[model samples]
Structure formats: C-alpha cells, structure tokens
Target: MSASNAQQYAETQIQQALVDGLLAEGFFDKVETEWFSAQEAESLIGQLPEYHQLVSDSAQRLWRWHYDAKAGLALVMLLRPGVTQAWEKVPGSRVLQQRQQGQALAWEALTPQRLIRAVYQGMNALTDTLDADELTAGQQVFLDALAVSEWQTASSVDHRVDTQRLLERSPAEFFAIMEQWASLLDRPYHPTAKAKEGMDEQEYRAYMAEFAQPVGLRWVAIPRERMLCGAGVAEGDQGPVAWVADEGLRQRLDAQLRERGLADSHVAIPVHPWQHQHALPKWLAEDFEAGHCVTLEVSDERWLPTSSLRSMAPVDGSAHYLKLPMAIYSLGASRYLPAVKMLNGDLSARLLHQARAKDTRLVEGLHLCDEGKWWAYMPPEATLFDEAPRHLSAMVRSYPQALLDDPSYRLIPMAALGTPLPEGGHHFFDDWLAQRGEAITAQTVSTLFGELCECFFDINLRMFRLGMLAEVHGQNAVLVWKDGRCDGLLLRDHDSLRIAVSRLEQHGMQDPCYRIKKGHSNTLYHDDLEALLFWMQTLAIQVNLSAIIDTLAGHYEIDAASLWQVMAQAIDTQIEAIPFEDEDRAMLREKLLNAPGWPYKLLIAPIIERAGGPGSMPFGKGETTNPFRQAGCAASHDRKIDTEENVAKESEALERKSLEREAQESVA
Candidate 1:
C-alpha cells in the first residue's frame, strides 16, 4: 500500500469507530436526521461517481450526520453494517458546509481529528453530567487512538503474505502463520484496538506478534515456599517449567541457583525478556534486595508470539504454549496474568470437562487447551490480587497431544478464519474451495459458510444446554478442521465462563466455585438463562462468526445479509436438532430468531467514559437491530420496523430537513 492509501485507510477506520461508538451510546437518537436518502444527496450536490458506487455496492450505505444545525455543517458518510451497531462508516466520505440554505454546498475532506472535535462538541451540548475536563480527556484519547492507528497502518503496508504457500506448510507451521495474519486485525472495528500504549515503534516491531520476531525467555528464581503453582504442576516433577527448558538450560539454571546460595529453596520460572528488562527492576526492587527474588543469567529457547501478544509458542514445535505477563495496556486494561484469573480458569476448565462427559456430542466435538499448569510469585504477605505479582507469572497452555500429532487435523484460530489476507483477499476458504472442486462464487461461498455455522453453533448450543458458555470470541475460539470440513471447536482462555447455577443443577452438573473480588461485580454467575445466552449471542455469533461473514462477503463479492441468512438457517436447524425442554426451545427461538434487537456490547464509549482509569475489561451495553431481521427473516412476534424501515424513516427525515433549511435560507 502507498503512504497515501495507508493514511486514508487509517482515517476511515477511526471515523467508523467514532460514529459507531456514538450510535451505540445513543448519541444518534439526539439528532433529527442521521441518514440521507439518495434523492436528497443528489438534489443537494448532484450525482457523483463515488456516491453512486457506494449506493450500488451491497456492503455499503450512505449516511448523513447532522453535525450542527446552525453552522450548516453536515457530514455525508458512507457506512456499512455492524452487528454491534446499526451502521459503521466507510471510506470516501465528505463533510458539507453551507453558509446559508440557498448557498452552494462546499465539500471538505473528512479527517479523524475533525470528527473527534465534532463528537466532543455534540457531547458537550447533549449532557450536563460531564465536565470540561472529562470531555477534553475523551478528545485526547480519540486523538491518541488516531495517531496509533496511523502508525499501525503505515507499519503493516508490506504484509502481503501468499495464501497458496500458507496452505502448503505443515499444520503447525500453517497455524503459526495464520496467527501472524490474524494479528493484523485485533478486535474487528475497534478504534484503538491495536494501540500498545506503552511500547514505542522499535519495541512494537520487536515485540508484536505480526512481526514474527523471535523472543528469548528470561529466567527468574524465587523461593520455592513463596512460589504459587497450579494444582497440576504442584505435584508433578515434569510440568510446564520443566517441559519448556532443555537439559542444558536446566543445568545452567541449577548452577546459577546454587551460586546464589538459594538452590535448595528456590525454583526458576521463565519471564518474558521485555518484561524482565522493563518491569522487573521497577516493580521488584524491594524483593530483590530482601533476597526473596533473584534474577538468573540463563536465557533459553526461541519462542514465537501468537495473536495474543503475551502468549508464545516454542520454535522447536512444542505443543506447550506459554502465556506470560506484560506491562503494556490494551483495551483500557493491563495485560497482566494474575493468579486469581488462572485459578478461575482452572475451575472453568474442570466444569467444561464435566460437561464433556455428560454430553456425547461435546465429547466428540469440544476440545480445550490444558490451562491447569502455571506458576506465580507470591511473597509472604502478598495476596493473589496484588498488582506487582500479576506482572511476573506464566502459564503453559498445552494443546491436545493427539490433535497436534494428527496430520489430518488443522487447528486454526477463528480470528484467522475471519481476517482477510492482504494479498489473497480470503483466508483458508479459498484453499478449501479449491480442495472441494468448487468455483469461488457467491453461492458456493455461502454453502461453505453454512457448513461452518453448523459446526460452530452445534458446539455452542450444546454447551449452552449444559448451562455453561465459553467466551468464544475470535481470539479464543479455535476451529478444528479435519479433511475439508470444520470438525470441532477448541477453546482456551477460560477465565470468564458464564453459567447459571439453577440450569447447571437441572442438567446434573455442579457449580465450579468461581472466585470474585469482594466489592467487584460477579459476571461469571448468571441467574437468568437469558444472561448466559447473551455470551453466546455477543461473543460466539456476533464477534466470532460475524467477523468471518464480513470477510467472506467482502472477498467473494456476496451480500453480507445473504450470508447472514445462511447463519439464520443453520441456527434454526441446530435449535431443532438439539434436545431442549419446550420452554428452553421457545426462549431460544424468541431471543435469537424472533427478536427485533440483540444485545450490543458498547466498546469505544466505555473507554471514553472511563477517562483513562483502570478497569476490568471495559464493557457497556446497548441493543442493535437483529441481523436476522436485517437479512429479511420473519420474526415470530411483531415488535418494531426492521433496519429497512428505519432507513426509510431516516430518508423521509432528511428530505424534510433539507426543505426546512431551504425555507430558512430564503428568509435569511
């Protein structure tokens, strides 16, 4: 990509996030006309080639934002559909200015900082609850996000990887390469998703997963009595720390421990080299001086990073994936590996294992990475929730040994499936199409997408029936491909499994005894089955599957709503096949298929509202028009007009606004 193209792409992304975040936070409801009909647009500015192209394209929509009525400053934006919000901005939009109604309209270039200021002024006029400082802080965050996005866009221009060569590699090799591709889009549609607030350019290139840079592991020796090990590792001699280190490295570690005169009482744990260089001395100075923690000189094993920057895979083809802590902030939260979270993940894994035993389908289809082996440093008076301790821990995520050894099975993270390759325009789907002797047409692509939905929803609904749901976001959910089909699902990062205690007992399962902080909210336990299903809707369907649909739609030139229709059909098929009580079936049908709106998780607004404070995963809630409704599926009950109706209403409003402005100009 050229420098100009990269800059344009980056600005487009930031603009989409700006409008989508406002819409999700109910800012659009405050404006009179938030869209422009084609007639209104052409009547005002004549028919432009780009405007016609945007309307002709099935994936794009033309929207108008009423920036300020008095200033005659309105933004004409081309947008696309988003599962979490009604519309997302597209590239090639222009801002319009007219001093009076009879005056000719002037078109100005759209920029991210300009949009950020407009949003700030709108917020200032909309609410009295927020003071100047809060609003200014929000503005600064948006600016920072824009700068970071520009950097990311410029940095990744040479990422045109070959898809055919990617398909020819071994399963493990392909998986790693896919992870590198996946790193290109972190959280799809998120504004500041790729911003590593702490790292500069050189550090970002050296440490980011997409760069595919080899990172060495730094060793730390803490007293054995103070070290906290997971249940699986505590009793075993051959655990993650042992498995990752070779005999030579182990000998070196032991010698260093003895020279420090603490060999008998201390054990060595691997640390991320960056973390050791930056975070350790800053946070562990007291411990080092008190002889409670010692840094070892031995470093070993070149490890490659996964999409999740903190996680690493051994270059020697080991299945033991290492997850370490880093001091950088992403998504408004520190990427720390606290023991409390690891313990909760262990409990969640145990429950999943129990569910697997109870359901035969899960037994055949559901797979989980073993996350039970971990180690953390705990001082004499320190608790599990301390901030410093979290930055110095590691967990070994072991893939199922059988699956790794099988040449027929390919483990691809769902993120990779959704992310379109820079060169090929599609991920493994093109490869799959070639293998199946099918042309890459709209119908064939939709058929392939339906098969994927069938496999994905099968595993998800089964777990839902068992009264639990994994956080199946794109990053955590791995689709197991066998031969040429999506065979199963493999889930990792199991800390936030949502469950209902009543539903669990009804299914002959027990609670996993999750730990929650004293005053913080308890999100793990849901009293309502609807709450549990929200995770299925938001993460599994909305985030994970919707991303893939968007990529497929763009790559194959198929309408996204057409693919969503396929999703609806697969969901209906699964709902009927899965054995559920009559009431449960009714609830699922009403909530998923018949509902006019689905729960939308607010992303950027919460960060703006947070004003750069520390928080657990930034989250807020709203509702969006159901994608099934947008796909033209019939609802069981009549609620309100669907997306098309909403568009028509906006169209009529735009016409009226235009006429009123003309009348005012005549008076002026």
Candidate 2:
C-alpha cells in the first residue's frame, strides 16, 4: 500500500479501536452504520440528534469526556478499532464494529482537526468523585495517553499494512514472508495510535521492532563512586560484571579508558539513546563536571526493542540483551528501570536458574533469561523520594541460545497472540494456527487453545509452588512454537519476580542481597504468600489468558465455555496429580475455576487516585463473579453488560453532585 492508502487504512483501524474500546467500557450498547437525517434524528446532547447520541451517550454516562464537540461528526474519526470486541464473549453487546467503521466514515470530508482532535479526545475511564483538581489530573492522563498513542504507530503504518496483506497467504507462503521479515516482526500489535497536538515526534523510529529498522544502542560509562552496580558472576574466569554491549565495543571502551588514564576507574554501560539525548544532560550534568561520567560513541550495530520498550536485542547476533531505563510512562507505570530492579532482576534470574538446575522438570520449555549485571549513576543531592535515576540505569540479560537453535521454532510474546493482524484478515493467533499446520476447525482451535492455556497455567502454578512468582503477563510470558505447533512457554524479565520470603526459606535459599539492609529496602519488595501470587493470577488470568480466549472465541466462533472446560480440566489435572500443596499452587486454579469473585486488580482505579511524585505503586482492588466458576454455564463465557449496575452507578454520581451543590449553596 502507498503511504496515502496506508494512512487511510490506519485512520479506519484507529477509529475502529476507539469505538470498540468505548463499547467494551460500556459507553454504548450498539453501533449503527446507517446515519439518520438531521430532522428525523431524536435530540441527544444540547439538541444534537440521535446521530450524535453515540458521542452524547458516551459523555453523559461518563464513558467519554465531551472535550471536542465543536466539530460535530468529525470526532468519530479519531478512534479506530484497536481490538474487535468478542461480542461472542460480551453479552448484551451489539456494535457495527467492522472495517471503515463509525458514522464519520460516511462524511464526505474532514478538516485538519481530523488528527489533532482525535488524539486529544483521549480515553481515561474515571470511577471516582471528580473534583476540579482530580478532573485536571485525569485530563493530563488522557493527554499523555494520546501522546503515547501518537508516538507508537505513526512510523509503522507501512509495516502494519505489509503484515495485513501477507497474512491472507497460505501457511508456507506466510512463513516465507515472515522469514523475509525480521524474527518477531510479525507481532500482532493492538492498533491504538492517534494524532495529537504538542506530541513530540518519535525520537528513534527503529527502536520499535515493528519498524524493523536496524539501529545501534548508545553506550556510556560512569566511575565506581557515581555508579551503583549489581552483578551476577557465573562459574567462569571473566570479570565480575557481564556486559551487554558487543565485545568489540567493550574492548574499544576499555582502550578509551586506558587512554584517559581511568582504565580501572570506569566501566561501560548501555543506555537508551532517547534518554541519553534528552534526559541525561540535566540529570547527569553534575557527574560530567565532576569527571565521574563519560559518554562513548557506540559502533552502529543493529538492535530492536522487544515488547518491553526498556529491553533491546541485537538484530544480528548477541548472547546478552541490553535492558535500559526509560522515564516515559506506559500501561499505568513509569517505564523507568530502577538500578535496584536491574540488580534484583539479575539476582532473581540467578535464583530461578538455581531452581531449574535443581529440578530438571523446570528445565524443559522454560528458559530463564538471566539478567546478571546492572549499573546506574545517580546525581548528587538525589533522594529516595525522587524518581529513580532511570535515565542512567542499564542491565545485561542472558539471551537464550537454546531456543534460537531451531530456525523453525519462533518465540512470540504472549500479548501478540490475540491482536489483529496489520492490514487485517484474521487475528494473529489464527494465522499462527494456520502456520502450526492445524486445520482451522473449532475442535482444533479448542484443543490447541487448551494446550496453550494449560501450558501457561502449569508454568505459573509451578513457579508459585516453588516459592517465586514471575509477574506472568504476556510480555514476560513467551509462547514457543515449533513449525506452528504450540510447545511450552519461555518466561523472561526478572525485575518483577516476587519471591515469598517464607517459601524461599522453605526451599533452602537465602540471599542477603534480597534482604533489607541499611536505610529502607530499595531493591527488595517481597510479597507475602498470597500477595506473591496475586500479580501472576491477575495479570495472567484476567489480562493475558482472558484476552486470548476472548479473541479466539469471538474471531473463530469457538465456544468460550468449551475452552473454559479445557482450562478447568487442565487445572483439575494439576490439582489431582501435582504434588504441591493445595493452598499455594492450586490457589489460581481454585479461584478461576470454582471460587466466587476472584481477587482482581483494579488497574484503572489507582490511576484515578493520583498521588503525586515517584510515589509508591498505586493499585486498586475489586471483584467480579468468576465466569469460570459458574456451574452449568452455556457454550460461551460472555460477560453481561451490567445495566442495573451502570444505571445505579450513573444515578449515584448525579445524586452526589446535586447534594454537593446544595451544601455549597448553604455555606455561601
């Protein structure tokens, strides 16, 4: 597709995503393709007709903020369907959520505001009493989301279009096409890009793997006094720290240090170019003047950012991946990689490595991406309360050579499983299933899906039972596929590994590095037995598996309930046969399969209650009836639109506002 055609396609897809996202959030009950005449339409908001009621309904219900209503129908063009709703998985939902969606598509033309307003009309769902201050913060959150969205998919339109076109081909042809592309290039990215004003253009384009642009990492070094280092040295004769950059680069860096008469005083570190260019000038100014920090020119070797923006891999070949700190915010948390996390991430990997070494059963499909050495430099006068010197931190992580041995085997990030293919013919997994040489049948999908789900759950449970919990979101959970057949999962990223203190003790493992020493536990955040498993359970079940199930069920018309039965059976198999205690290992299985209202992390609620600064992690909690637990549930696992609940929620807000006004009047 030409750039123009790609933009057109992107506009449509982006619009579709917003509508679908809003629908999922309960903004509208249905979508209508046909537009009503101005006279025939009923009044919506401020005498706007029913045609405008879609936007009006979204706003009045607090599902949308009526920020840019001056432009009428053009507002609809800003969003595209990021993901098609599994109406099959969402009961009481009807949306004309197809290609070239939204009534705005019917419009003959749009103004320049098409991109600007669309991006500005951001989505940040609020579940709190909105005061002036709170409302301002929410708006900022929405704007930040808008800016991030704009930054993401702008340069990848052609790449996305290419993937979309190729997915329609046969499996062999698709495989060939993918081979032409970079490994891991065919990830199904959820289309959420928007054009927003005041958004800085992407500083680095190829940092996005989807772009497949070959780029080099920026390298730098700081002295020992200025830097905090966490290193894991294996049983070898090399230095204490494992460097992630090229060996040649390391040699050159060493030579440079020798030339400067600082050979023993300094060490090299890899840093995100964006951070180095933008953030470090101010943050590292003191260090540079004190002769503690020095920037080194990195030879341009191709690298690609993985699903997590902070981590990057060499495009050609490398034994270790470079994990750098980024200060940007995405997915509810600042993307900064704290030095503490970088160090602990490696230690966490070492712990897991030891576990796998002890039990060969844990070794099969599970490959621990060990992060060994991390380095960070903090500016003078920086305090604990200050945000982490994320701009100055870097870690070296082990790249699994074993998994890369077979060219036929592809390791895909779990989140990519359910996303719509770029250009659009089917979900990513559908194309994946085709590649697996499985006939595209309901039975095949269910059976294979069950296997995948079982593989994921088993790994998660087994980790918890062994006394560690890897925050098992799809980004960290990689699906290993050989010739399209689903094999076991490969887990990566160590920073989020929550170790249970008691369980680790029981397992005969103790590390002073993981303990609290001196002023506050910076690197250590141990979770109790229950909390240890919460991240795994919530992120995997609710966020990852549920998403995949929704897509497979909706897109393939496979029975969600049947899939649930498979999951239940898998859990039962683990429960009945596995040697682990019921309390720890089977906890996830019990909640998802049989318990009422499993503990769910309220992701949005915490974002709503914004506590300023580098504040402690904000998380919320709420419970919904576990769909998996329902007895005699039908063929589908669709969540019903909470009509009564929504009505009550909206009414209570209205009533509360009215009372607030009356109280203010009396005080006046």
lDDT of 1 at 45: 34
- Give the lowest summed-lDDT range of ten residues in model 2: 88-97
The digit string of per-residue lDDT tens for model 1 on 401-499 reads 877777778888888778765544355787887778875555566778999999999999999988998888999989898888889999999887889
TM-score of 2: 0.70
Give stretches of model 2 more than 4 Å off: 1-134, 154-158, 161-199, 233-255, 357-359, 378-388, 426-437, 482-485, 510-533, 559-561, 582-589, 615-618, 629-668
Tens-place lDDT digits, model 2, residues 364-388: 7567766665666765566423453
Q: RMSD (Cα, Å) of candidate 1?
A: 8.6
Q: In terms of lDDT, which candidate is strongest?
A: 1
Scored against the true structure, residue 73 in model 2 reaches a CA lDDT of 34
